[model samples]
Each structure stands twice: as structure tokens, then as C-alpha cells.
Target: MRRPNIVWISTHDINPDLGCYAGVWPGAEYARTPNLDALARRGVRFDNAFAAAPICAPARSAIITGCFPTSIGTMHMRSKAVPPPDVRLLPEIMRAAGYYCTNNWFTDFQVDLPEIVFDDCSPEAHWRNRPTAETPFFAMFHGMATHESQLYLDDDAFAAATAHVAEADRHLPADAPLPPYYPDDEVFRTAWARYSDLITEMDHWVGGLVAELEEDGVLENTIVVFWSDHGKGMPRAKRWPNEAGLREPLIVSWPDRLPTGAGVTDLVHTMDLAPTMLALAGLEVPEAMQGVALFGGEGALRPQPNEFTFGGRDRQGEADDRSRTVRDPRFRYIRNYFPDKPAMIHTEYPDRLPTWAAFRRLASDECQQRARGELPSAMTAAQRAVVAQSKPSEELYDILADPHETVNLAAEPAHLDDLERLRAALDSWILEYGDLGAIPESDLEERWRPGGRRPATEPPEVALEAGVLSLRATTPGTLLGWTPDEPASAAEPSSFQSEIGLPAPDGRSWNLYTGPVAVGQPIWVKAWRIGFAPSDDIPVRVPVPV
Candidate 1:
């Protein structure tokens, strides 16, 4: 009767072990997604849909614009120095197409598109009040209630969340073998138990949203899709290329639109969302959109299948990282330009993970099988060396068999055919998408509160102009310097105030500020007091070239 309304619900870092997807929210007897399951029962359920980038900002960008994160230089979460003004996001398109587009608050500025989609990151972001049939709407919502390492809960909630787990729900089936690599230990189990509980909480939240939709009388006419940015934000799980990190649960529920209550195993990527929306809305998909819409009501169907979508690995330290993943329903091929550092290294050396990105804690039984494995004596030396190094430059996985992707069949003699094919395919994608490897490595974008200044180490050049020396304190902290020629001292200037906020740290350069410097004066300001560490002094010769 009406142009079907569109509602997209996205969550962060949640795997498919929940009740509606995997039963139990991966929790103890807690596949608690009755609402989602009920929704699924009425619509087409996608079994193999995936995020173009199994990450947050990247995935969000993909969904909003229907393009791969790498194609837009947005391969990693919080990587953009600033949100792009050119790329036409779906919300903008929908707005032009006469659809009201809105979202709850706090979307990263990197993905912010003015006059299209707006957010307010408060608890009330998801307030539902849409006009009935006046104009079709495309509303996107997010669930931040069950964030990783959710330690800010009230005492009672925290106690219950961290409660001990029972034995029965803690172990996998006897036939379910542990992955070749990984430890099986109480440390892993306990962490997994907590992780599951968190999922249960998220599921309960989703149920509420669904109930809201049903109550609003728009549930049936809406094209509803639910997904997560990535897997659980645990050690290797979050920032990893492994299946656990990349594998997500995607469920598409659209009643009486195309197909209903049937599982379509076709692989779908995140970026495809934008193109899909554009196509479904009877709008021409821009060539920039490297994705295609696969599901929708009238005018959404294509005569043939669209090409593959990609995922990128440019998060945190991986900023210099060049990685590309290509998948077509049957296979997933990955090429890591910097293979010297395997994903596991982040676990062994948490420092390997990006400073800006904080994954969930080590509190899950998901590692029990890995922990139980015997240490590899034949190559412990080599393995350790490899872990110390990055990963191999090339990797290929037979996803159907090794869904978890622990074994790097890249070297296996038997799968050479698939490997070469997928590798070529993955490489071709990198070229086609014009993915420049990690553009803003040192250009941090994640915002963390500026705590009091910490200690110091390296000192670079700072410049002073307009009575204010651009302190550029590495990243951002209180003003730190000495009178004229003080040997790079660290002090928190109580009187310091910045006109703008600090740029996030990409493991490099700080835009430290100094009070007011003399115009055209040669001031050597250095980053001394910092929030994390006193970083190397980055010397800047200011009086910026005009």
C-alpha cells in the first residue's frame, strides 16, 4: 500500500552466538532473542550476510553509503581524519528521494553527513515517533547498551553479569574439536561466560526495540535488518582477521516483500547496503558504491548477481596495514600486505592492538579448545618468532570447512587451486577498489577524555605563533613547556585552554598546544605531559609557511 519503510538496526562487536542466531545469545541457557526470532519467522532470514568490513566505523560507513570501507579510504573504524563531504551516503540519497532519515545519537564524526542523518548518543537516542504514511522513512538505530568490557554497569548488574557459570553450558559438544591453535583454560572459559551474558542482555534489548516497532503498527511494512559491526571485542576476537573477528550474524526480516521465513546462504558484504538501498528506492546507484542491494520489495531485484564486496584491515597500528578480503558465497580470500604480524600477536602482545581501540577482556570459554592443545614443540621457536613478526603476506581459507579459520590452508599443497584463484580475485579487488594502504596511520581520530598529564620521553620541535606556540603535545593533554629555553619540561598548565579538541593518536605526532607564543617566534615546543605516555618529542618549526 505504501512505499515500505526501512529500518536498520546495527550493534557493535557481537558474534552470532545469540539465541535468535545461534541459540542462547551464546549465553548459559539464554538464547534470549524471542523478539528477533519472532521477527525472523515472518520474513526472509539471511544466513550468510556479512559486513563489508567486519568492523564498526567501516561497517557503518558501508551500510550508510553501500560501499566498501577501503574503496572510500574508510577501511578501519575511527580512521578518517575527518568525515568526507563528497561521498553520497544512503541517508542523503533517501533524503533527496523524499524519505525522512534519522538515527539515535553519537555516530562517529567520520561518518557524519550533514542534513541527512543525525544522532544524539544519549540513552534516549532510539525514541520512536515516526509520522504515519505522510512520507516514507529510512531510520537507522544502534544498540550501545551492551558494549564490550561493560564495566560501567551498576553494582547489582555488574555482580550478576560477572557471576559464575554452570558446567553444562560452558563446554562445546565432544565432537566439536578445539581449533588447531588456541588455549583451553579456565581463563578463556570464564571470559567466554561473561561474554555470553552480555549478549543475552543485548538480545533482551533488541526484543524491546522489536516490541516497540510492532506496537507502532509499522513492523510488518518495514524492511528490517539486524547486524553487528564485528565479532566480540575480545583479545583476538575483535581486531582479528580470524573467523571469530570477521564472522558476524546478519538476519534480514522483511514480511511479504521478496521471500519470507527462508534462509538465503548467499554471502553479502556491508558496503552493498548503500547500493542496495539506492537500487531499491528506484535511484541509480553511483559507480562509487562498490556494493549492490540484494533484498527489497518492488524494483529492488536484479536480473543477475552483483560482483563481490570487500573488507579492510586498517584499524589502530594497522594503519600502515594493507589488507584486503574478497568473498563470494563459497570462499573468503585475504591478502595482508603486512603479514609479518599475525592477528594473534595482538593477544600475546596487547600493545600490538591499537592504543585507540580497547577490546573486551579475556573472560570467555571460547578459548577452551585452544587452551587444551599441546604446545607445538617442532616449531615453537619459529612460531614464537612469527608471532613476534607480522603474518605471512598471503592467506587462503576454505571457509566452509574451517569456518573459524584457525588453520592457514594458504600453504597446504592440496588447496593451491582455490588459494591462487582466491588470491587473484582478492588482488583484483584491491586494484578495482583503489584501496590505498592505510592513509591516516598517524592521523588518529578516536576521541578519549583527556585525563591529567602522564610522564614524558621523546621531544620534538614545537612552534609558537600569535603569542600562542602551537604546543602540539603529541596527541592532546594540558599545556607543557618551559619559559624560553627550558629543557623540555612536563607541566600541566592550569590556565591552558584549546580553541579546538585534540586529534586522536595514530601512534604518531601530537598537536600539543602552548599558551600564547610571540608572532613569528622560533619556539621549540615538545610533547611532555600526555594522557598515556610521554611520547618522543616531535619538533615542529611553526610560523607555518604561508
Candidate 2:
């Protein structure tokens, strides 16, 4: 095969807990993951893999671009991920090289504006009538079931998984190894086991996918790469720079080509996945990829990748835009960009699900009793003395000594030398990457405002009383007629209040409309934009009580 086909399978919001990572604790050995384990046994397993970001969207963007998430202005998740139109995505690069690239149902960049990314979202969700074919093929399939939102899996699956969950495991897994941030308790154990249950379910899907490829006869020649976009949604892990949140599971399999049953401990960041995959496909990695290929020996005369796997955290945990972290094999250093806020906020609770309650109750208690634990004094002092103190923003920890990351050596007299060194390294690498975040804090507001996708013509909001509906419009955009569930017709403006504009030439966009939806009747509204953003469908449920 010229260069075998490439298939990248990624799951959302999960961490490495397989036969590979040798549980952060001993109990994690049983973290049900037969499928991922099989892949590990069949190919190369990376024990030290880190994500470019500890959250979704940004990390996914980084993995596909082979650059730090911050460089693309997608440092935060969906909130700040608007890349200007000129940026070249990985798939587009594949198209240039004559590879038939395809993706199943996702492209966060295309989610908001499909036209900007996909040539067409038809034929199938995001990959059918693609533009290339002379060379090898590349396709990405997302494991949506692993998303935390689906943790509320219909009650039936929950019942089956937990049916055998011991009362001990039900209250929590047997004396679970409390991550350093948490106090040992029932809530933490129970929640972790439930989370593990979800992991098992996700793994089954991964195993099924591998089997399908084998059936298709593409298993041997294709490069199968499996990874997560980022970390699990645990308090310190999900949004913070801590390992529980930043480390990722990266399993690569190509039975006949790449070495099998070999484990590479060299530190590799998730951002490298795109470039690495492209390299495997015989494609040139663009200059924009800030990562190195796993197969390419480190970068010096005897080139070896830096000893650390790297990533950062931006506004995704309890609150936002508050914390950051840098990790190497033995250390995890955190920078509290906003130190004034409580490290443990009430918002981290995933209130609707059972798993959220388990993790929360422990993290919440940890926040409540700062005096008893082995937590550093400065952290305690900062917690008590700072009213959202943004100072003493730096922290460094020796994970080998305290994997839970309980110590703060930033202020410790002996570690100051190492701390200053890492900070300078972080700043230098950040600047060299041309990351948008390096723009001096003072100029950020001026630099980032005009790129919003809110719409050239703002949608009108409607309110009605009796038979009349009030309408408002921007100076140049007119008010068309009523479209309760569909587009409002300009010819029937008298029947309902709506703006009559040039009809949108595209099919998926929508136009707004409102009329006398009787107080006691059922109705819904769809906002339309003919050639712009996706048709926004918001269902307004109104029922008159007898």
C-alpha cells in the first residue's frame, strides 16, 4: 500500500483509564475497558499523552490542526472558538494532497456555520460527497456516547450496569483512591464507579468499530488511531491543568506497518495527532502544526521530542477564564489566572446526573474543610485572604511525590528556581507559537471583537396581545410577515407582522415570523437566515389553563 488509509476515532470528554495507563491508583486496573485494551495489545500504547487543551472544542481543534489551541483563538471551548475564514483546516489540507477525507457527524468548526467548512452537509451529515480521491483515504468518526451529557443514558442501561454494582460500589467503589484534591468518602467512590460504567459502555462501541473495519477488510492496511478530545468532567481534572483533566488515552494500531505491542513513553501532546496522522498518510505536515510526528525522532541533531507532554486549561470548569496548567512526566504546575475565585465553585456540580453528585459531594467537602488536609498553606491563605485574588497566580507540584497535586512549591523557597524557569519556558513557547493569548492583556478587547457570528441583520423578538403582534427592525433590515413554524411570505404581510426581504437563496437558513398565537393554543417559532447561520429552531410551548 502506498501509504495506508487513516481512520481517526475520537471520543469526547474522557481520560486514559485502560490496561495501559496502570491506574493512577491500583483499583483503576478494573476500570472496564476491554476494547481499548485490545487495541493497546495490538499496537503501540502511549502512556504519557497530553491534550493541547483540557476541554473540548479547543482540544479537538488543536488535534486536527497540529497547533496549540490558543494559536487559533479557540483557547476556550465554544465561547471563543471563532477562527477567521482564512484559516486552513486539516481536512482541506488532505483535499489538496488528493486524499478522500471524510468525517461522520461532526466538525465543531462547522457546527455553527456549515458552509464555511463543509462543501456540503448533505448526502450525509458531514462527509458524503467529498472532494478528493487520487490518493489514500482519511475519515474521522466521533464517539458521541462518551460525552457527559449522555451519562444520563436512558434509565435502562443504568439499571443493567449498576445491577451488579456492589452496595459498597453503589455507595462508591471500594474505598476508592481519593484523588489528592478530594477527601476519601462515599460520594467520590460511588460517582467514580458510575463514571467507569460509562467508560465501559464507550469501550464496547470502540471494540465494535474495530470489528467492523476488520469485516470491511480494511483492518490490516489502515492506521487506526484512538484518542479523547480531552479529560473527564471531574472538578479539578475537567477544567483545571491537573492530570486527572489533561492526560489523554492515545492508542495507535497498524498491525503490518507500525510496531505492534510496543509502548512509547516519549511525551507526546494530543495536538500532534493531526500532523502525525498526516505523516502516516504520506502528506506533508503544514508549517502551522506546532507538534512533531510521533514516528519522527525528537527535534535536535539527535532530535527527540521534549520530555514533557503539554496542554493548558481555559475557562471550562466551575467558572471560566480563571486557571491554567503545564505538565511534564513528574510535575504539574498550575497558574491561577484568576486567584480571587474559589477553586471549588458550586457550578462544577453536574446537578442533573448521579455521577455529578458523587464527585461533587467530595470536591465540595474538600473546599469546605481546607484546614485538615495536606493542602499547601498558601492555597489556604489565598482561599481565606484573597477576595478573588489574582496574585500569587503561579503554582508548581512534583506529581511523583503528590499525584493528587496537593503541594504548592511556587512559594516554597527551594523550588523558586525551578518555578521561574518553567514560567519563562511557558511564556517563550506561548509567544513563539503566535498564540492569540500572547497578545498583551491590554490589547485583547480591541483585537477580538469584530469576529462574532451574531448575524449581519439582527433577528427581531416578538410579543403579542389580543390580535396584534409588535414588530421591531434594524434601520436597514425590514420587518417581514408571520412565520410561526416556517418562513413568512412577503405577499401575506397583512395576515401577520413579518419583514419582507429578498428571499434567501440558500435552503437551510431561516427567516423570523410571529402572529396571533392564541393564548390557549400550541405554537413554536423558527428563526431563519437564508444564506447565513443554520436555521435556529426554538420551540415555545404555551398552553392555556382551563
Candidate 3:
């Protein structure tokens, strides 16, 4: 059977605000995303897909590894200094199955993958570059036009990018609706309008890629997947555990394999994509994968529809916050580990926006007034309450009743039973996954960075026994590589490079070397951890038969 080609197109910081999502907010209709809408019409649109982590690096890590970021100690944004070698990425597994993999130069893996994972991983990478036309391919194209940083661009930069957007489409309604938490002011309205225009630009890129597939005559045999990393780039949405932060737009199109124009209301997590792709390719999903394949043939590990999905948040940039949440179909429960911290903590990135700047100005003025023994006068009492309020330990919201999640029902006696049930579910999940977020960031840094320096990998031990080479490392998850020792003068440039062999069998240390070698030939072996310093090379000369 011929394996279907897979093309994953991912965007940054976008939620389901497209026209097809039926967003009722003012100016939502101006979100010109006809390409995505058409794709939804010709494919399966997932109504309840979520990111396991709210931030970029952590969320992308979960998607690539089929495990929660917290489980792998990568929950902190941009904190994956070194990869845990034991964790095998999805691309590596696909490559092992004879699939030619390529990524269009955007990787926030948060963990180091074996070099063998992608045949090409650069701006020029494409499936067409594959040596054989018959080779099944897996390609990922990342679209950054809609990224949150685009919102903060200076006037000139914004103009250069949005010049193509028609003037009428660029302006939002005067009374544009915003989340309750945001101040309904001109700055926010303009921001939302600009964001909508960026999404339209992203849609254009998506259309171009699909058109290319059609032109190549590969559309019929390809499975195309489109999704965003997390939620909208607004203040409350990006880093918070609310629906806006976790919910994502997911559409899958595979001609003749799945029903078109169908909407699946089943709750799904981003990590599930790894297992789903493997299962669709008729390969075995790894036992360590925490996600379940939602669509595959019989014998696939399909999760129960509408099962509760989970999300988590950790350190984002300079702000240190820890929160976890569990969401079923209608109800959402959140637990803030550090309840004493205010929601408006000082973060450099968000502070760039006028909305955040206004809050900070009010907060600063309030601090000065307190210093003078006077009550705050800069902000209204309600606004001051929101700015100064520390988060509650527990929050419960009926999403069906309060889609904005503005009202908290945790204190209500009528919802005690529901709150307890969801709280218990969150606790069980944390324990089952061995959540690393339970450990403080300072403590983790000490362990992961001993002596105040990045960790160093331990060298793998090499031995020759029974005419076969054996390699082992004491550190768990250390990846091993080896090459035949060659002199500088006689060796080609590529000869100095070592190939990463199969991972340790126990995920700790043990990889049997399988290569043709004559007795007395010397080999050099080394160890590496994705974000850390590599181990020193060890040379071992093969022994002659006695």
C-alpha cells in the first residue's frame, strides 16, 4: 500500500476567529479567510481542539513529542536549554518508517531531535527535493505573518506588511467588541483590526501552498493539516488558561479518506496529532506517547469522543506563574498554584502594548498614592480591583453560560460538587504525568544547570563483544553517535561527522551498534543532549578474533 503524504501548516497565536468559526464579535466578518473557509468546507473541522501548553515553545514541544510539556520538563517558555535525549520526536519516527521529512526552517522544538529526523530542514526544504518520486513525504510549513510579534511592529513595518489589505477591510467597527478583561478603547480596536488583516495574509499563504500541491498533482494522495500553535495574542488570551489561550483551529483534509464538510465536536489535544499521523501511516504508535489517535483504521488507539482535555501554563518570559486547567465539553476548572501573584504582573513583552501600558501607569500611580497614605484616584474602583486582585486558588466557569469566562463559580455552593470533580481530575492528571511544574523554577535551574552552567552530557561507553559493538551511557535520555576513526588527511569533510544511531533501549542507556566493521578497525563514539554541551569522544579499536 502506498503511504499518504502529510503536509502540516502551522500558524502562531491564532484562535478560531475565522469567518467559518462564526465569530460574532464586531468586525469578525471582515476576517477575510476564504481559503481556510473553503478548506473547512472540503475537510473535517475540529470544534474543540486545544493546545496542551499556552505558550509557543512549550506548546510546540508537546505537539512534536506526543506528551505534555510539563511531563518532559519543558513547560517554561524558551526554557528548553537542552533536550532530554530519551524522548524521540514524531519526525524521527516517521523518518524511520522510510518517510522523507522536511521542515520549512521554523523549529521551536524545545528539545533536540536526532539529525536523522529531517532529510532537509531549512528555508529551501521541500518535498520536491526528495531523491525519489515514490518516497512518501512529511513536510511542515510554518506561517509567521500572524504571529503575536507582528502586532507590535512599528508603523512603517506594519504598513509595509498590510499595504495589500484594502482600506475598507483594514478598519474595524467603531464599537468593536472585545473580551471583558480588555479596555474597550481605540488602541484595542485598531489592534484587533490589524490582527484580522494579518490572518487574511496568512490565509493567502495557505492558499498558495494548496495551489502548489494541486499543480504538482499530489493533492489526491496527500493529507493536509492546518492549525495554530495556541490562542490569540491578546493580554488575557496568550498566557492564561482560558478558552482563548488553549482552544485552536484545526482542519484536516484527506481526499476520499475522511468525510468533507463534517464538523467533529470531540475534544482533542494538539499532542494527539503525532500519534494520529503515525497511525494513519500504518505504523505503531510508541508506547510512551500520551496522546491517542483520533482517526485511523481498526486497532488504532482512538480516544473516547469528548473526553476532558488538559492545559497548563508556566513561566512566560520574565513572569513566573503556574496554572493548570481541565476542560470537559461545557465546564472549565482552573487552579492557580501561586494565588498571591496578581494577574497584571510585570512582563516586558505585553507591556509594549498601549493597553498594558495604561494598566501599568495606573498601577504605578496607585503605588505612589499608597506611599502618600491616600487611596488610588487614577483608576475606578472596579478597574483597580481587577488590577490589584490576586488570582483565586480555584476558578470554575460554565463555558456554555459564560463563554468569556468572566464569572467565577468556585465560591458558589451550588457548584461545589462540579468543582470538586474537576479539581480531582486535574490532580490525578498531574500525578499520572509526573508534572514538572510542581518543582519551582529556581530549583529546576539548579539541577538542570549544575554549577550555574548548562549541563554536560556523559560520554557513552564502548565495548566489542562477540564481533558486535556495544554502546551505553549512564545519563538517562542521552543520544549516542559514532563514526569510524579516520585521519584528517585521508578523510572527506563528511567523515568527521558522526551519525546518531538508534536511541537507548531503556530510554536510559543501551544502544547496540549495528555496522559493518572489520576486526582491528577503530571507531569513535560520542554523546549529546539537545541543548547542552556534548561529551568528549572516546576511541575504541575493534579486537581481533582469538
Candidate 4:
């Protein structure tokens, strides 16, 4: 069978609030995710898909590496991590297999990745841009309409993002359903409405992309995977280790190899996605990858669906609280390392959002009112618990009965067995993987950088013999990337470097070097080690046959 083209579309900070998923959530009625719903109907919807972390960078790092962020020392948000030797990126591996890989704009992998990882990685990137129509391509599209920044963006910015959605389709604040943790107020309601509207806008974006696939007459030959990096961008949901923070919508549709309108309740971690894609492409899932392939892997590489999914939280922006969580099919258990710290870590980034600001106001009002022995306050105790001074050391919640996770049942005898099971599981997983979050960030930085400076990969040495080029880098675990086309001019080299250094169009004819290449002309080779700056390209001229 010919390898199928893979198109992975991801939305930002979104949960299972689509029109599908049984339409049970508060904003589901207003969330007109027609495109996503249709995709779900034609694909297998993973009802229990979760991310390795609640935040974007950590979760995305795990997704790309197929290893938990904690295991790779990337658990902290916005922190750089040096991947272990022998580990390679999914796109790099795919490129080696003659696949045209492209990422549409976003690549916050939390590591210093080389430019040659993708053929194109800009907003203009598309699978159609591949050199040949017969080449199988892997394209990643990021839908940012539902991003957290959209919730607090200026009116003009928000207007432009959701301009495609009709005014009639926009949700009303009054009709927005309120979560149990949020106070009853207009600000929170308006936040919900805006989020729902953005989801609709994202749905429209997904529709357009799918339509393009159909127009190209490759929809049947392509595998469409739609998912979110994490969950809702609300205060409690976005960064917390609870269900709303970890669980997200996952839809995989491949008309040729998969069943239709099926719901898979198996526990799937975002880290598994990398290995799964590799397996689907008829490639070997590397032993370095910790995740199991969901679809295809022979004998020793076959996937074993998890009985429980694990997640972690640490150092989001300004906060330093550490926590870990494990979720079975029905229950979630959270272990807070710093029970003295509040669940709401008063970070400036989240405080800028209107919803979080409203939450702070309500909490403040309730505090003052309670001090004076006031009869009633705007925030209920359940709502105030999030903004409370301290958190419980351990929390267990029966998510089926209480999706909001407001009530903690860790101490309850009725749920002792379930709690213990998950606790032991979390402990075993952490011990096996070695939680990097346990180490202080300062110590880790010192170890990684040594002297507070980012490491740079040594340039690769290129040799040409008998019209064949051989490349090697002195640095351990360095990846070499070469292009048969050299720069047109000296000035072009810097421009090419800039393109690779930043998230710009990488249209250069770069190829991942797996072995010696038979080149009859000059070639440009560069070296890069993960978590280190890439080396400058060196040109090597191959002898031409006379």
C-alpha cells in the first residue's frame, strides 16, 4: 500500500467542547464546530485523550519527542531542554524516509531545533508545495483562533480573528453556561462567549483546510488528524492538572484504514502521537521514544493502551508550584508537592485576562465580606477554593460525577481503593521516568548551559570522494543536514541562516543526512544538536565526471 499523506491540524488551548462529544458541555450548544463534528463522525474520536502537561510548551515538547516533558527536563514552561543522545525528532525521521514535512507557522518545541527539520515551516507552508505530486507529505496546521491570547486581545484584534463568523452565530454572554469554579458574573460569562465564538471560528478554519484537501482530490489518500494541544484557556482549566486542563478532543480520519463514527475510550497521551505517526508511515518507532504507537507497530513495537494517563505541572511562567496527576478511566488523582501554595498562582500573564481578573475581584470581595461577618458574598466557597491560600496535599475526584473537580475525595473512605491505586501508579511512573521537575530549575540550567550560555553545535566536516559526499560532526549526537543547492551569493547565506533560526519560510533544498550522498555538484552541510544553536553551513564541491 502507498503511504498515506498525513495532515495534522491542531487548535490551541481547547478542550472537548465541540458540537460532537455528546454535546454535554456548557458552551456546546453555542459551539458550532460543524467541521470538527463532521470529522469526528467520519473518524475515530478518542474520548479520553490527554496531554502530558496542561501548558502548551511542555505538552508540545512531549508531543514532538514522544517522551514526557518531565523525563526530558522540559517540564517547566518556556524552559530549554537538552534531549538525550540517540533521540531524533519525528519530522527529521520522516524526512529521512523521503517525506516532505511542513509545519504551518508554530513550533514551540521548547528546544533549539534545526531548520532542516521541515521543508517549509511558515504560514505559507502547505503540502501542495511539495516538489512532486507523488511524494507523500506530512503537513501540520495550527489554528490559533482559540488561543488564550484571544480571550484578552484588543477589540480590533478579536474582531479581525472572528470576522468570518456571522453576528447571528456569535454567542450571548447571558446564555453562556457558568462553570462551578467561576463566580456568577458578566465578565466570566463574556469570556465564555468569546471563547465559544473563537471555537466556531476555528471550526471554519478547519473546514477550509479540509475543503482544500478535497479540491486537490487527495482527501481520500490523506489521513486527517484534528486535535488540541491541551484544554480550555480558563484560569483553573488551562494550567491545572485536572480534567479540563489535560483532556482534549482528538479525531483521526483515514477512510482507507480506519472505521467510521467510532469512539475509542482508551487512554491516550499526546506523547503517543509522535510514535503513532511514525508507525502509520511504515517507519520504525524509535526505542528512544517512550510513547506507544496507537495504530501500527509490529511485535516488540506494538502499542499497549494505558490503563491510566499521567500528567505533571511545574513552573508556569512566574509560579514554582510542582504537582503530578494520574487519571484512570473514571477517577483523577492529583498530588501537590507544595500544598502551601494556592491553586491559583497569581501570575501576571493570566491576571491580564478579564475572566481571571473577575475571579480575583470576587475572591477579594468574599474575603473582605467574610472578615466582617457578612451574610453573603459574591463567590461561593467552591469558587473561592481555587483562589484560596493553600491547596490540599492530595486530591481525588470522581470525574464522571463531578466534571468540575470541585469536591476532593482523597480522604473519603468510599474512594480509598481508587485513590490508592492511582497514587501508586503515579509514584511508579514518576520513579521509572525520573521527574525532572523535582530538580530545581536553577540547577538544571547550570547543568545544561554550564555557564548560563546556550551551547553551539560544532560545524560538520564535509569530504567529497568519487562524486560522493561524507559528512561528520565532532559534537556527540549531532545531526547533519545538507542541501545540494548552495547559496547564490555570500549575502544569501546570512539570509538563509536567519530563515532557519526563526520561524520563517524554509524553501531551501535541505535534506536530513542519514548516510553518504552521491552528489555530482557542490553541497551545503550544517550541524545541530538539540538544545544548542546550529552551526554555520559549510560548502563542499564534488568532482564532476568528465
Q: Which candidate has the highest TM-score of all?
A: 4
State the weakest 10-residue window (summed lDDT) of model 4. Answer: 496-505
lDDT of 1: 0.53
Q: How close is candidate 3 to the true structure, as a TM-score?
A: 0.83
Can you tell me which runs of candidate 3 are displaced by over 4 Å?
23-30, 81-86, 171-175, 298-303, 362-386, 452-546
Q: What would the per-residue lDDT of candidate 1 be over residues 19-53, giving only the tens digit for each residue?
A: 55553122314434555666667665555566666
Better of 1 and 3 by lDDT: 3
Candidate 2 residue-wise lDDT, 142-203, digit = tens: 76666766555566877664453344323236745545454345555655666677677677
Q: For each candidate in the order shown, give its overall lDDT on alpha carbons.
A: 0.53, 0.58, 0.76, 0.84
lDDT minimum window of 10 residues, candidate 1 = 493-502
Best by lDDT: 4
What residue pairs clash in candidate 3, if any at all? 82-531, 83-531, 86-477
* Each prediction's number of clashing residue pairs: 65, 21, 3, 0
Ranking by lDDT: 4, 3, 2, 1
RMSD of each candidate? 13.5, 13.0, 6.2, 3.1
Q: Which regions in candidate 2 have their CA more than 4 angstroms from the true location?
A: 23-27, 80-86, 109-135, 151-157, 160-172, 297-303, 346-392, 438-546
The true-versus-predicted C-alpha distance at residue 129 of model 3, in Å, is 1.4
| Runs of candidate 1 exceeding 4 Å displacement | 20-30, 81-86, 112-116, 119-127, 130-133, 151-180, 296-307, 317-320, 345-388, 438-546
lDDT string for model 3 (191-227, tens) is 7777888888888789989999999899998989999
The per-residue C-alpha lDDT of model 1 at residue 392 equals 67
